[model samples]
Target: MDFSDLGKLKDLMGNAKLMQEQMEHRLSETVVEATSGGGIVTVRMNGRKEVLRLRISPTAMGSTGSDLELLEDLITAAVNEAGRRADEAMKSSMQGMMGGLDLPGLT
Candidate 1:
């Protein structure tokens, strides 16, 4: 390859690295919230799919006479929804960074 082509390749690699770093920073800063059971259970997650916070309404935790299984279900639903939101956020961020370029294995 010519020296000019080599220089261009290097520049391309540097740009790619910069974009990756930017995406990582953006993912860390991005946050999403999800709720289940009519907001009885809520979850907040980052674009990395890490749960940052979880909240359960006092009413969601039923009295001693209430059903424990229902509470568990609500929590599970909230967490799953949070994860889905995180995934969507990441996907959207990636698309923006890539400028809609269809990269294999990226989606």
Candidate 2:
């Protein structure tokens, strides 16, 4: 309401914007890899939970129905693991950045 409070709010908004930009940069830079079925399926994902790369070993591929089902499951598991790791990485990177901001509804 007061001029001083308004000025402080402006500064807080600026800081929040800067932090969001930094987090976006970090997200693009952060890469997480995960494997399933003893590395038969490998997944590389970014902090945004986007899959960057996927690799399935030759031995893991087959023509049979059961083999295909197993492969699908393995891929699913690997992608999920990669996404989980990405979330962890983002949290770890942003840990100390939000310490004192205390932005209402954001913290």
Candidate 3:
């Protein structure tokens, strides 16, 4: 609209970009690990939705002649647990960034 309004909009956009960049940086620095199947499998993920590491316990692999389906299930369960932890980590980071404002659907 007016010059002042245009300036305000530009400032708002810049602030939003800065905030997003800070959030992304913080998220990248956050890491979370989750395990399942009695800690037989572990997964590490960063807040940026990146998988950093995966670990399988010896006991989990010691199942010789075991059902293939069972192993698959265990792996799936472990990965799902890791994903859950990742989501929680993301929420926590966002909450802190937003000053405890849990904005619905922002994620």
Q: Count the backbone clashes (under 3 Å) in each candidate.
A: 0, 0, 0
True-structure Cα RMSD, model 1: 1.8
Candidate with best TM-score: 2
Cand. 1 Cα-lDDT: 0.88
Query: For candidate 1, lDDT tens digit of each residue in 22-101?
Result: 98898899999999889988999888888899998888766664457887888899889888888888888888889889
lDDT of each: 0.88, 0.92, 0.78
TM-score, ranked from best to worst: 2, 1, 3
* Candidate number of the best lDDT: 2
Residue 82, model 3: Cα distance from true site in angstroms: 1.6
Better of 1 and 3 by TM-score: 1
Candidate 3 has an lDDT of 0.78
For all predicted structures, in order, the TM-scores are 0.87, 0.90, 0.82
Per-residue alpha-carbon lDDT of model 2 for 5-107, expressed as tens digits? 9999999899889989999999998999999999999999999999999999999978899999999999999999999999889877777677765556543
* Pairs clashing within candidate 2: none
- How good is model 2 by TM-score? 0.90
